[model samples]
Structure formats: C-alpha cells, structure tokens
Target chain A: MTRLRFAPIPAGLPATVPFTGPETLERRRGVPFVARLGANENGFGPSPKAVEAMARACAEAWKYGDPDNHDLREALAAHHRVAPENIMVGEGIDGLLGVLVRLTVAQGDVVVTSDGAYPTFNFHVAGFGGLLHKVPYRDDAEDPQALTAAARDVGARLVYLANPDNPMGSWHSGALIEAALDELSADSLLVLDEAYAEFAPDDAIPQIDPEDDRVIRFRTFSKAYGLAGARIGYAIGPAKLIAGFDRIRNHFGVNRTAQIGALAALQDNDWLEQTRRNVGAARERISAIAQDNGLTALPSATNFVTIDCGANGDFARKVLAGLSDLGIFARMPGTAPMDRCIRISCGPEAEMAAFAEALPIALAKAREV
Target chain B: MTRLRFAPIPAGLPATVPFTGPETLERRRGVPFVARLGANENGFGPSPKAVEAMARACAEAWKYGDPDNHDLREALAAHHRVAPENIMVGEGIDGLLGVLVRLTVAQGDVVVTSDGAYPTFNFHVAGFGGLLHKVPYRDDAEDPQALTAAARDVGARLVYLANPDNPMGSWHSGALIEAALDELSADSLLVLDEAYAEFAPDDAIPQIDPEDDRVIRFRTFSKAYGLAGARIGYAIGPAKLIAGFDRIRNHFGVNRTAQIGALAALQDNDWLEQTRRNVGAARERISAIAQDNGLTALPSATNFVTIDCGANGDFARKVLAGLSDLGIFARMPGTAPMDRCIRISCGPEAEMAAFAEALPIALAKAREV
Candidate 1:
C-alpha cells in the first residue's frame, strides 16, 4: 500500500467534523426533524427580493463569479459607510475564518478564544497547527477581557471573541469590547466574530474604526439576514490586512448567485425589519415554552434562546436525546456549566409550536431516565 | 500605525490576483462584452432542470447546505461506480486544490507542475509556501513524463497536471497518463485535474483504480455541467485521502443551491449529451473562424479552441487586446510558445457570429500595431 504524504499538522489531526449537521442526524434517525432549530440557522427564511434575484440568476450560472467581488463589495461599502477596501467578502464566515487563521497562525503559534466558543473557528486554528489557549467564558458570555488577557499572557498571534455568543446567547456591550482592546497586546490581532450582530441590540454592536489594524470584524448573512444556504459573508478590517486575503484566498470562490442575492437582501431593509420582528416574536415564544416546561430561559441578545434544563450536563444530554427522539433538533454547548443548557434557534410559528409541544414530553422522558 | 502580524509565508508574498476576471475588464471598459468567450465558461448554459431545481431551492436558502453533501456524493458515487466514501465534494476544484495543497505542502515543500498550467493551482502552492518546480510543456501538451521526472528529482510532495490542458486546450491519451504514473515516485502524489474531462474524447478519458493512492482525480460541474457560478466540484481518490479532507475543510462550505442544481444537472443526461453536441459544433465553428482569419486552430478535446496566430507571444497578445477592444472577451496562455495561441470558449450561435465578425477587424488592428 502506498502511503500518502500529508503535512505534519494535518497528519497528526483526526478526521473530525466540527459539527454534525442536522441532515446527518436525520439520515441516522431515519426521520427528519419536525423543527430544524439546530446549527443556529435562521429558519425565518431570506428576503423575497433576494430569493427572486437568486432564482433569476440561475440561468446565468454558467459564468464564473467576479473574482474581485466588485459590485457586492461596493454595495457593502456604501451600506457600512466604509471604503470597499475595508471589506473582504468570502464563501462565509466559516471560510473567512479559515483564511484568517492561515494568514496569521503558523504551526505552534499561540492563539486564544473562549473555551466553548465556535468549534468551526477552533477547527481552523487546530487544522493550521496553532497552539490554542482557551479562556473560560465568564457568566455565559464570551468574556472579551479574558480573551485579551489570555492573548497577552500567551504572546498570542490571534484572539477570537464572538459577540452575542453562541450556545449561551449572551452578549457584552460594545464599550466592553473596546475597553478590552486597550488591554490586548499590540502583536495580537483581535478576531471579532459578530455573525449574529444583526440580531443583537445596538449596545452589543461594536463601533471599531475601519482602519484599526489591531482588529478584524467578521459578519455574515447566515444569521439574521437569513441567507445561510447562500454562503455569503464579509470581514471588515484595515485595508492592508484585507488585501492580505487576496494573497491566499480562492479569488473566484464566492458563488455568483450568492453575490446577487446578498446584494438584493441588503437592499430590502423592509424584509430585514420584518425578519427581525419575526425572530423577536419567535424568541419570546421559545422563552415562554421554556418557562412553561419549568426551565429558565437565558436573556438572549441574539436570535437563539438558551434554556437551562435546571440540571447537570448529563441530565441536559438526556433531555437533548429525548428531544431528538421526539423529532426536535436542538444542540447545546460541548463543555461543562454551559452544557446544562440546550440551545434552540428561533423559527416560524409552526416550528415554535412543534418545539412547544415536544419540550414537555422530552423533559418528562429525561426525568424518568 | 500598528503593524499587523501575518505568518511568514503570507507576509513575504505580494497580494496578486491569479486572474483578472472579465467583469473587472467590463467595469474598466465601461461596457459588457458582446461575446462572453473569456474565462472558459460554457455560454450554452446549465440544464433547464438544474435551473428549475435551483429556483425551487431559493426559498430554502435559509437552511445551511448538508455538510456531508450526502445526496450529491451518493449520486456521484453511483455515476462513477464507486463507494460514497471515495468522493469528497467541495466548493469547487479551486477550493479543493487549496485544501489539497494545505493538506500536503508545508512551507518550503517541493511541488511540480507544467509551467503554464492552471495559475490557480500555482497560487495555492505559493500560498502554502510550497517551492514549485515548473517543467515546460512538451509540444503545447502537459508532458506527464517530464512532470514525473521533475517530481522525482525534486522529491516533490505533489505534482499537478490538468488533463485536457487549460489555456492551450491540448490533451494526451488516457493510456499515456496511466503509463506515466508508473514512473512517478510513490512519495509524490499526482494531482490529476480533469476539469475539462466531459468535453474530452473517449481515448483521452483515463480509467484509474478508485482506490489508487498514487493519484487524486479532480472533476467539476463548472465546465460541461455549466454551473461555474454555482462553485461545486469533487475529488475522487482513496477513501483515506478523501477522509483527510474532513480534517481541515469548511464542513458547510458548499452552497445549498449548488448542491440541488448539480444533482439535477447530473440526472439530466439528455442535457449533458446536448451540451456535448453543442460544444463539438462550436469547436468546429471556432476552428473554421480561425482558418478564415489566417490562424491555425489546435486539435482540441475540450470545450475551448486554442488558435495559433502563427506569430510570437507579443503578436497574439496584441490580437487579444484588439479582440477585447472589439467587445470580445478572449484569453491567451501566460507563458511563451503556448502564448502564441489565443483561447476562446465554445458559445452559442450569436456569440459565434459576433466572434467571427470581430476577428478580422481585430487581426487588422493587431497588424497595424
């Protein structure tokens, strides 16, 4: 047998998927989930204008997308009130994160992030052989100060902090993020992942200068914009660092339909407002359901609500398994403390109703177990 | 000014785009091309069934694409008569190449390829700090023997060969490719890029063992399948190597619309057959046009035709410029010898007529220059 030669980093790594998609579970279970709330995908759907644009662009699928991503970047520049050079659009935040890690983290380089933060980001860091120094979350939020201190302590190259944190649905005020930046080492670049920013309160959205070389902010259409399947996202940062992406990125990687659809979605402010309203309503409904089932719903600044099952990680796992058995696809944090909670995405009325109906039965089964 | 920390490899590299897309040209020229023949895109377009499926999937753009690409991989496995484990779906051939390079090539790792083969592959190699040793094309064809010799000499970890070669539209028989593999070092993996396989003649189609660990074959829907804008492709290889992709790839990177569209496109064998016929006719038309313009068309087993201008690289470049000025987007090889030819993609009748009309004027302009 011919032995394949893989780089030392990849060879040492296990073939592990960062997250098992809900579809894989469906295949394993032999039944589709009644409410697709896992993966933090927006179930409210994308704008009608965006859908129309994508559907229209289907005939033009033969042409490769603009390698420069010109028009969309220009539109995004106008939307953000920054120069186009400040924005670099990519396949998604996931894709951008991989590139960012590659750009900064060489093998054995130190990096910092919250312990139970985005596994996809961690996956990229590990894939590149970066030495990860994970700081524990503070009170369910991705503590910016902790991340900064860790970066400084480790002499880290990159530090990641996701605002409106995942799995816990908690957030820090923008001022806190800015304050934390002051303590960050000059050599360490802050990777501010604001994927759920559009769904967060204004106080939770940071106002970093576009020219700030110390930081790069990642934003995506997947969350509140409801174009998750389109796979479009952008990173905002100093022009110099943004230009670095062109050095290594697959120039024509972004899908043309995604470019057209994201632009249309960005233009339809009415649709965005309506979706926000829908998400807010769904969050309330989910929280209400959680309270009725004798669980405490965390105060969420993002689209998802994390409900405390009022038990340990094992008990929460049993509850999660029960929910899966009852055809409600949900997820939880991978580590302790936070693992006591189950994360559920905000969806339409029917999905919320389905979750509402299933939660009690799942909780009852978990108690029995 | 704060100095951003980039890894040594990326920091030393200049930010260069591999290719300047035609859209960038259009924006610079302030007009869309009359004949979109550049970028080797299929002007014949995708199957109607694919367009329909994509259109239907537009509403489901809220859900993330299945990370496993389960359905598409199953269909592809059936089509190729291989197990699903042997197939690894990615964003595109370009995206897959990036991952492949990341997996195999570390900094200063030696790699080999034909000098003027796909620039995107070169870009990925350089991006990963791989030391590329270029072997000149033998008689306008990618000399597999030369590539193998160079890989053996340099102790290369990876060797790239685009079958049905790009830019020159040349090809070798499958038997020759199989025979060349015998000389390749066991340590050097052959990166067989069959992006244009659908357009190749039967003799040029290589039949390699699916479990062969010495080579990994890349295939794409962006070519004959007419889904370039969709950005979908797959790599067929030993299950071990295929599984290694899961260690580093963006699990949810492939777009949902692309998955649905490609599956539909694959099922529509009649559309593919029709497309092949269209491309063949266009090749003949393009050849006739070249003959009329006092140029010699190279024998091609691909959708595009490379027309030798019977002059040096400069003359052909001048001719390319003239064609661009005439609202015809065409391309040429970047290196010498092969650069004497101008490449044109197969398009519909109207585009053919436009190219035919513009060639004489462009030639006249080139001669004057």
Candidate 2:
C-alpha cells in the first residue's frame, strides 16, 4: 500500500506536544489532581461580567464570528492606544506564533532563543523548518542580551524572549529589555511573549511602540484575565508585520464566544485588579511555604513561583512525580540546572493548602530516592 | 530604515480574506443585516443542552482545554463506531484545512480542486505556495471524475472535494464517490470535506473504513449542529494521517467551552434530528420562494438552497447587491456559470419571511441595474 507523503519538514519532525496537559496526566493516573497548577492558568477565573456575557452569547453560537474581529480589535486598540491595524487577534499566543513563524521563517532559516524557554515557539520554528540556535540562560532568567547577540551572530530571522520568564519565574526590568532591543540586529525580529504581562510588575513590562518594526509583542487573556480556555490573544507590532499575518492566518479561526468574553474581560478592570491582588497574596504564601519546607523560592514577577529544590534535576523529578502521586499537579523546567527547581502556579487558598500539605511528603520521598 | 522581510510565499501573496464576513459588510453599511442567510450557518442553533453546557463551562474558562481533546474524540469515535485514534479534533474545518495543507504541501506542489470550491482551502494552498489545478464544475456540481483525472495528470499531492457541495447545494451518491475513489491516484490524498454531512442524505456520506489512507473526511459542528461561532470540528481518517496532526497542530488551540459544547451537542441526537427536519422544511420554503420570483432553486441535500437568478453572473451579483440593500445577507459563487446562482442559508420563519419579502424587490432592482 502506498503511504501518504508528508512535506519534508513535518515528515522529519517527531509527533510531540510541547507540554503535557494536566488532563492527560489525570487520565493516565485515573484520578483528577486535587490542585491544578501545572499549566500557569489563573485559578481565580474570569470576571462575572465576562462569564455572563459568554453565557448570553451562547444562543448566538450558530453565527460565525466576525472574521475581521473588528469590535475586539477596536477595543484592544483603544486599550493599548494603538491603531487597530497594529493589533491582530488570534487563537492565543501559540496560534499567533505559528502564523508569525510561517510568515517569516522559511526553510532552514536561522532563529534564536534562550535554552529552556517556551517549547511551543520552538516547536513552531522547527515545524516551519527554521534552524534554532539556543543560548544558555543567564542566572535563571532569559538573557535578552545573549539572545540579541546570538541573533546578530546567526543572522536570525526571529528571536523569542518571554518576559517574566516561565519555569524559572524570573524577569528583567523594562529598561533592560529596551536596552537589549537597541542591540538587536536590524534584520532580526524580536518575538516578545508577554502572556503573563498582567501578572508582572508595571516596570517589568516594556513600553509599546506600535511603529517599531523589529519587535512583535504578544499578550493573552489566558493568564491574568482568566480565560485560558477561551483561546484568545493578540500581537502588537508594526502594521506591516501585523498585515503579513492576514496573508496566511485562518481569518475566522477566532471563536466568537472567546472574542466576546475577552472584550468583556478587558472592560472589567476591577476584576483584573482584584485578581492581581489575589495572585500577589498567593505568591507570598507560596514563598513562605517554600521557606517553611527549607527550599528557596525565586523572586518572581509572574503568577507562578519556582522553588529551588536544594538538589539536582533527578531529585526535582522525583519531587514532581511524588507530588503527582499525592494529587498535586506541578511542573518543572525541562533542561538541566534550571530543572533543579519545580514550578508551581498560584491558586486560591484551597489549592495552596493542598500544595503545602504535599510538599514535605514529596520532598521526603525524593530524599529517599 | 530596513524593512522587515517576510518569507517568499507570504511576501508574494496578497493580504486578503477568503470570504468577506457579513459583519464587515454591516460595518461598512452602518446597518445590521435583517436576514443572515449567508455563510450557511445553522440558524436553528445548537442544542439547548449544549448551550447550557457552554454556559456552565464558562466559569472554568481559566483552564486550558485538554490539548489531547480526549473525551470529545472518544465520544466522536463511539458515535461513528470507529476507534478514537481515527479522529482528530481541531478549532474548525478551516483550521484543520490549514494544518493539513501545511503538512502535505510544499512550495510548488500540485493540488487539485473545483474552480469555485471553498475559497479558504484555496487560500491555504496559495499561502503554502502550492500550484493549484482547478477543474471546472460539471452541471453545477463538483466533477469528481474530472478532479481525479486532473490529479493523475498533475501528480497532485492533494485533491479537495466538498461533498453536498457548497454554493450549488449538489451532491453525488456515496456509491459514486466510492467508485471515483477507485480512479484516484495512489499518490494523491483526497480531502473530502463533509462539513454539511448532518444535512446531507445518509447515502451522500460514504461509509467510513477508518483504514483508507487515500481519503480523509472532515466534519463540523458549524453547520447542522449550529455551533459555527464555537469553532469546533473533527477529521476522521487513517491513524497515520490523524497522528500526523499532533506533530504540527496547536495542541491547546481548541477553546475549552467549544470542546464541552461540542460534546454536549454530539450527545443530543434528538436535537440534530429536529434540526435536520427544520432544514428540510426551510429548503422547501426557499425553493417555493424561488419559484414565486420566477427563479429556479437547485435540488439540495444540505441546509442551503442555491437559487439560479435566471441570468448571467452580472445579474446574480446585482441581485445580491439589491438583497444587501434590503438588509438581507446572501452570497453567490465567485466563478462563471456557477456565479449565476445565489446561495441562501436555512433560517427560522422570521428570517425566511424577511428573505421571502425581499426577493422580488431585489429581483426588480437587479433588473433595473
């Protein structure tokens, strides 16, 4: 029998998901996690107003969403103080990143990123046949300077940097990122992912200049806005770069309920502020718990906290597995050195309590191993 | 200033939407559409149970949908009497098409489709730099034999066929499609888009072997299931082709509420039966309306009727403009011969009455033009 032929890129690629979702673990284990914190999802949930709006819009689900995403784009533009053309809404940062890579990264093109950064971006770069050059992280944070230098050295078409970086939960200030941007090669485009921007301190977020052609920043409702399941995010960049997305993106791909709910979520500033306060409290409590367990928690600008396990990667792996066995879902970085720390998302009191109760037991088991 | 460079494919392609959504038209005209009979969306709406499920799921929106889409795929598998491995759920058929094209089509690859078939598929092919070979429709229907012949001639990597064809509302028998499958080149994979399958006669949908490597069929909740805005769909094919999607798809792309709603919608078989009946009645009513206006409605096995304007493409276009002027939203085919027909979606009595009342006026205005 003749086999279906795949393009060389996909044919060479291994079938893998960037992250193993919590549900997959639950299914494999035959039991649901008592505390769900693995994926950096907001535990506080979306605003009541957004929830109400989505519920109300349920009956109208028969109509296709505006392929243009006009209202949402307009709202986002007003919120960000940019022209509507500078903003392109899509099915989350992951989806938008796929389109961006498709637009810029031709086969065997060079791209640069810090080691152990977002795997989905790397997956997209590989899927598009881009050759990725990875620079080591400096002090457990994404080294923007190293990334920019590598881009210059490799003639990189794209460079990815996650602000308030994931896994390690460390961040660089806005001034530092701006300085790094000045050093970026003119030919290299910076892919700034700010999925956790709402959780980051104000100084941690760089000022938006929509006219800048060398950088595209992504923001999402999945984290601070509590709409991860909605799958809505936007990229802010030069109009020309933004326009390039329309040439290849699925125009009607944004779910209508997601668009409407995101709009409502955007409008509810009080809810956002309250959620921020809740996250701040949870972060402090998590740090205190880490200290109580004789572990050091890294300073974080994002919603999650990464704890140094006071041991090696194997010990941390054992700790993570033990936590899963104890019905607490958490994750750690995938690479060495950084993998010595386990990452846990901030949630409400109950989830925090679950984590606190399980940590010592998991650590004990890891020590036994 | 150096300009940001796009890869050659997108650089050469025009930034255009395949279909101009009705919302775009409404924004331009500053008037809401009174009858949305365009886009072939199911006006009867999703099951109330599905709507309620979505509404309930809105609170849990902070969690990412299971990237595996395990439960829904399992349900779809059971419903179809196939194994879960045969099904791959995605954002929509539009999204799945984009992924499929990316996986199969490389630069300058050959693809075959009917001249006036779904433009989104064509857009994807062009976006991927595929050389498309278009075969003309025969008797207002997609010519399967011609498509297979063209595929063989061109050594096409992909051949696209929309069963219960769009715009013309025509279909071939399952037996006929099975027969045509015999003639399809071994090297070519058939993309059988059965998005309108629920409304199609049972025989119009071919029996699923789940082992056939030459064909992959796409079905959607967007049409008869009435969840177009929710943007959920699935493809059933050989496990190898189905597994290939995991290598490149956005694992977390499917919205959580959409997955939940689709599952609920699938379980409500009674609602689907009612919707089919409603569509059957609407088809009759639309044909009757066409006769009243001295137009001819093509025989339909789907949720829409394609009305022959009894003139050329120009006349049909003018009639479409007239309908737009009367606050009725309708669409027509984009190519010659097929372009002489205007397609209308089935809706409730209110929208139907609006279209019924506007047809003659639109016809008169069209004649004036």
Candidate 3:
C-alpha cells in the first residue's frame, strides 16, 4: 500500500503532464533548438512600453500586486470598450479555464470538447472528475453544431470550443460561432476560448451583448500581442458568472509585473498592429516554404501555420522527430487525421531562415524512416 | 428564471475577497498613502540583481515562460538541497492553497484552521463546498495541541498552521512543531505554511524526511527576499504528492518575468540577510512607537508587528482609519480580541518615521472616538 494517499480525483490522476515543454525536450536531447517555432508564442516581442513599465516596476518587486487588479481592469475596460465588471483578469486563459471548470463541473459531471481540441482543457475536466465526452472534428475543423448536440446528448455542464483553434490553425468566422452559440443546449454553459482572438480578422469576433450569460469568452495577451510570458488574460461574461471566479480564483495569481506590463501593452495600439502585420508576413513565408517542400499548408488566421504532412501519423511523427534532430522546435497534433499535420509558429527572420534551411533535410530524413 | 446558472456550490459562494490590498483601500479613500506599511509586504525591495535580471529579460516578454519552470526548479532544488521532484513552484502560496484545496476538499469535507487565521484559506474551503471549523488561538498563538484535536474531531481533510503566523507574528520552535507533527491525526493532511519562516529563529523550521508525504510545507520569496511583486512561491513534499500538482495546476500559470526575477532574488543571499536585518530593526522601531503611544506591541519574529491598542475593537478601527487619514497604511485583525491590536509592516526609514510621526495624532483621534 502507498503509505501516503491523495484525494480520490488526484489519486486516480495519472502523473502525465498536459504538455512536455520544449525546454524539457531540449534538456532530454542535450541540445537547444536552432529555430524555436512551437507553442504559438509571439516572437515579435512585447511593446517597448510594456518592457519599460516592467523594468520600472522591478524596483518595487517587494510589494504584492494589487489584489483587486483595479488599474489593469480599468485599463482593459477602457481598451476593450467594456465595463470593468465585464472583464476578469487572471494568470492566463489557462488559469481562467481551470476556475471555470471548477465552477461548472462536479464528480462524474458530463463535459464536451472536440476530440483534438486543447489538451489543457481536457486535463482540467479530468482533473475535476468530470466525465468528458469528445466529438470528433469534421475535416480538422471543430464541428460546432455537432458539439452542441453532444452537449445535449450527455447533458453536459460545459462545452468548450476554441476559435482559430490551436495545433491545426483552423477557424470558423464569428457569424458561424454566433450561430453555434444560439444552438447550445440550455443546461450547458459555453466556454468560447478565444485565446488567439486578437490575431483573427476584425470581423471574427461576435458582437454579443456584454450582459449575455450563456457564454464566457476567454481572451489573452499571450498570442498576437506578444506578452505570453506575462501570464495575463481576461474573461468576459455576465456579472453573475464573472463574480463566481472571484470566489475561487487565486486573487494575486497574476504577478504585479504582469499587471503593469499588460496595462502598458494594452495602451500601445501601434505595436499591436505592427506585430499583427509581422505575423501575417511570417505566415505567408511559412506557407510558401511548405508549398515549396510539397506540403499543403492550411490557410490560417492564427499566428502559426499547420502544414499537412501528406502521410499517416507515423510518417508525421518521423517528420517531427527529424525536425527536433535538426534543432527546430515544432509540434504536431495529438490525434490522427489531425496528426498528419505539423504546426510552426511565427518567428524572427533569422529563425525563419533556419526553418527554411532545415526543412529539406528534415523531410528527407522522414522519407528514410 | 436564469438562462445560465452555475452549479449549486458555486452559486452559494460569497463574493467575499481575501485581503483588500493597499491599492484598493487607497482608491477607496481617494488618496494613496505616502507610507504603505500594510498587508505585511516587504518594503525593503527585491535584490538589485533581480531588478537587473528582470530589465534584461524584458526584451523577450513576448515569448512564453518555460511551462515546466525547468531552470527555476533546478536552481531552487540546489538551494534547498533537495531533488527537483520535491518542489512545485507556483504563483504564490495563495495559488498553491487553492490547488491543494481543490485536490483534497470536496463538498462538505471538513477543513480546520484557526478562528482568526488567514481568511483566504477559509474562502477556498467555502468555494470548494468544504465544512470549515476554527480553533481559537491559545494565549495569542496558534495552539498545535488544539489544532490536532480539532482535526481529529472533525476528521478534517486538511489542517493549516502558519509558522511566524500572519497578523500575529508569533512562532513555535521547530521542536514543538515536530512534536506536534507526531500527534497530528492521520486522517487530516497537515499543511505547514512557512511563508514567514525565513524570519523565524533557526530552530523554528522542523527538518523532516524530504521523502515524507503526510505533510507539505509552503515557502515564498515574498517575505524576506522581498519579491512579492514577482508572485513566486513553492510547496515541498513527497514526489508523488508534489507531482499531483501537474494534474490540477495551470502549467503556464507563473509569469516569465517572475521566473527571471525570483531566480536572481534567490541567488542574492546578501540582500536577503540585509533585508532580514532591516526588517528586524524596523520591527523594534515599530514596537517602540507602539509603546510610546501607551499600547503594548506583541513580540514578533516576522516582518510585521501587531500592537495591542489596549482598547476595544472600535478604538482600533478608529486608529486604523486615523492612520490612513494621516497617509499611513496599516491594518488591524478582523476578530474582537485580536482586533484590539493593529498590524504594521516594517518598512524603509522614511515610512517608519512617518508612522512614528503620525501615531500620536492617530491615537488622539482614536481616544476621541
């Protein structure tokens, strides 16, 4: 018998991490990456204003962050043109998702997600002892209508859909997502994770009433805004559900430096636009490179490109391993059909050049496998 | 009827917050205090090296921090003379508390704490639908003997005790705590929150087998190292229990700047020692100030001193508000007998001088009240 025991959920929880970070992979390999393009982190960097703000705040690191997050909330409210009550800032969308899961899910409670959706969300559901039922994606695209039906079928407490979804860099427009929201079953709360929302086209986000309670939208500065390291994000929903987060959240989970950096970042619209433009250019470059290598790249509205590897799961795994051998850090989809694709993040020109140079050798090695 | 509603447990949760930060209180009072000596935050500041590290790290703010916190965990492991598996870094003790509560506490599970202990712990229990019971502090300190009995009586899922306790600043020697550990009931998991352990005497920390799993200890850089703004702290326990955090924790919850800043802070032993000395000296100054006003200051081993106003709760509140009015931010305990004391954090010479200059006026105002 194990001398020490954990509570049931944690006891049954396999010690499997949601994702093995590239740094861990590097440590195991004993070599750092030549081109770090995985995880969809913005390589364009944060606004100088944000950097300066953090630098200035560093001297005052002895003080805890303002627990209320008043300044940042007010600033986010002003920037998003929404009331401060409509926004709940947190450690990141990852942190916000955990709280949402706790609020809605109980032991054996039903939850729904796309089979190949964000693994972190699945981790939360399983961690909470929620019975997770996954609907398969239709052609690497999240079938929202099917997801809604599954929620009704299972009588799920929550349904999650990530727009411009990760791993595949696929998307459906705001109009379709709004239609999906309308189709959601009454008993099910919709968690529309828009972590990559800022990178999508202007019309991609639905113009919903801020007071609507059926869905809570998760947004983060981690993607196109290039503040991933800051660990700051916000959720927008009706005050009733939003207030529930305050009941369970780590009040000071968001660092004081993050609060200061995010506030500064939200103010620098010029830098955001420039970064978005850079992402667009990099996507085009990556797409062209994929085409030259005889791989089909998915049209993306995200900060990364997911290229179809033109083979089965094993073949794609070989390609991924080969890339790792070439000192290029990239990732692939966890589930098949989607597994026949490899994802690459936008990076600086130097890193992009490294990717272009490394692809042919990596592909040849995959063929040998 | 509400179209969207949370589970009954979540809906039942209060909108109550933990501690109201000084910033919030400042905003409420329509002015910022010149001397912020509230919340027990270290005012001596983080190590200069940490600030320099943060400034250098600013350019890469766009990249996501290592989700595994690899380098940081390695450094901390070396510092504590333990394996990396023994430590689980988090946003702070607050974040870890939330996770631990979720892992062990289910609806109606019994959780025990001191009557006037950290309110945040009570808040988490309530959020998780746990039954919360409190034991009164015996003779102005947390009585481990009572705590053990309460845990056994309630069959508590968890029992918490903070060494060099917050709000009170009293401590028990490690020998006493170690003795208490043996008497602790097996049903309840013992949580020794050592947030202020650095301020305690050398013998105050019990050295147990690092491989032991029945108890967990949490430590933070927020106190003596003065890096509260970085939001970094850790829980050390058995490998199995420590690894359990991955199943429930937000893998990327900790911020990048925090990792960089805290790593540098940990290496600066000189700064840590100097800050401890500064906090000690300032504690003496604060005690002297309290005695000057004809009140008794409780003996403290932490960064803050709790002064008995020697009057009723009403008198203490009046004095706290008066201090606020005089641009000095200080707090008082929430309960009646403890409310007879007002808490003040040790700070820079300027802030301490401000407290000394303002105490008499505040006391006079309190007397009139």
TM-scores of chain A, one for each prediction: 0.99, 0.99, 0.98
- DockQ-wise, the better of 1 and 3 is 1
Off by over 4 Å in 1: A1-3, B1-3
- The candidate scoring highest on DockQ is 2
| Number of the candidate with higher TM-score, 1 or 3 | 1
Per-residue lDDT tens digits of candidate 1, residues A214-244?
Answer: 8999999998889999999999999989988
lDDT of 3 by residue, A1-369 (tens): 232565678888888878878888889899898888988989888899988998898898888888778998888778778898888998889888988888778789899999989999999999878999999999888888999999989998899999888878888888988898898877888899998888888777887776877788999989877888888999988877777788778887778888888888889999989998999999999999999999999988799999998999898889888889989999989998899999999988888898988888889999986
lDDT of 1 by residue, B239-351 (tens): 98998899999999999999999999999999999999999999999999999988999988889999999999999999999999999999999999899999999999999
lDDT of 3 at B307: 96
DockQ of 2: 0.79
Candidate 2 lDDT:
0.93
**Candidate 2, A117-168: lDDT as tens digits:** 9999999999999999999998999999899999999988999999989978
TM-score, structure 1 vs. true = 0.99
lDDT of each: 0.92, 0.93, 0.86
